[model samples]
Target: MSFVVAVDGPSGSGKSSTARGVADRLGFAYLDTGAMYRAVTWALLQRGVDTADAAAVAATVGEVRIDSGTDPLAPTIAADGIDVAGPIRSDEVVRHVSPVSAVPQVRTRLVDLQRRVIVGTDAPGIVVEGRDIGTVVATDAPLKVFLVADPQARAERRAAEEGGSDTAATAASLQRRDRIDSTRAASPLAKADDAVEIDSTHLSLDEVIGRIVSLVEERR
Candidate 1:
């Protein structure tokens, strides 16, 4: 039986860590849907596609081939057989991902690919994390979690992860991403009605992971 655990949250909300932790504890494969978008964004930028032009992005979508690894401990993303795992996470790609991902066609193509990845998994199940996994990609998932944190807390966490990057700048960037992701036309970031909401503003990573693990166990 496929026991999918869908995790959704805004940037810096600990979606990736908590989801990976849960998948590791349960021995399920992990999928970071956001990386798929980042990979496509990286490819578009590499090809000099104008990210602001939705039509141009949509037209170029098929030209990029994105493949993601499902291991929670070593999740990977490659574009067209090139190991772009490092390049896709650059600040430039981060800035352009929102615009490229906002394109309806891009979302459609990626969503379908995401589903295929989950279905092809041979593990007990999969834990999929993204802004819209619960709301759009896996609405029928047996377990869904929506993680949130105080904006300040999220900013601090993200800054620390980025090698003590500017807290103020990171906070502003995260809030900006939240606005764009939440307002986008295609598969906007949202919490599913059936999902359990976890405010990690004060909770440690283990605490958040534990809470979701209990939920998964109960649902299973």
Candidate 2:
């Protein structure tokens, strides 16, 4: 049986880096569920669909094929056979992903895909990270971590990730995304009651990864 680890958190909370690190340390498969949503958003934009229109998004979501490679060292995502690891991170997709992800049909479809990936992992386990992983995607995961960081810290981290983008604007955009994601009608961003909450504001990436890795060891 795969020992699943569900890492849930808001944007820039270090869920991606921490989860990937944990997976690498343990030789586990890793899945970034957020990228699946971003891939869908990128597909919608490419198809000229208005992502803000719920109906349009729902109607068109199934037509997009999203593939997520699980290798921790070189994870990749593709939308309709097109490599989108880079495109999904573009500013346009980031701006529109929350809305596209809020569509019930979109969540329903992607959550099913995410579960399949988790269950089919050839490794002994998988570390899956996203807003809803602990609560919705893998409630039965052996270890659930809800990562958090102060808004300012998150903004700085995101700015660094974006190659020194304006921190103020990034902070504003993160806040906007937080409001949308937490209020979305579908699987909203929230901490699962049983999750271990880690405040990453002052924690080094190595420290965070080490903590989660220790938890996984304990659980095993």
Distance (Å) between predicted and true CA of 51, model 2? 0.7
RMSD values for the candidates in order, in angstroms, are: 0.7, 0.6
* Clashing pairs counted in every model: 0, 0
Lowest summed lDDT window (length 10), candidate 1: 81-90
> Tens digits of per-residue lDDT for model 2 on 1-220?
7999999989989989998999999999999999999999999999999998999999999899999999999999999999999988899999899889889999999999999999898999899999999889999998999999999999999999999999999999999999999998899999999999999999999999999999999999
| Candidate lDDT values, in order | 0.93, 0.95
Q: How many backbone clashes does candidate 1 have?
A: 0
The number of the candidate with the highest lDDT is 2
lDDT tens string, model 1, 1-220?
A: 5899999999999988999999999999999999999999999998999999999999999999999999999988999999888998789999999999999999999999999998999999899999889888988999988999999999999998888999999999998999999999999999999999999998999999999989988888
Poorly placed runs, candidate 2 (over 4 Å): none
Candidate 1: regions farther than 4 A off: none
State in Å the error of residue 103, model 2.
Answer: 0.3
TM-scores for the candidates: 0.98, 0.99
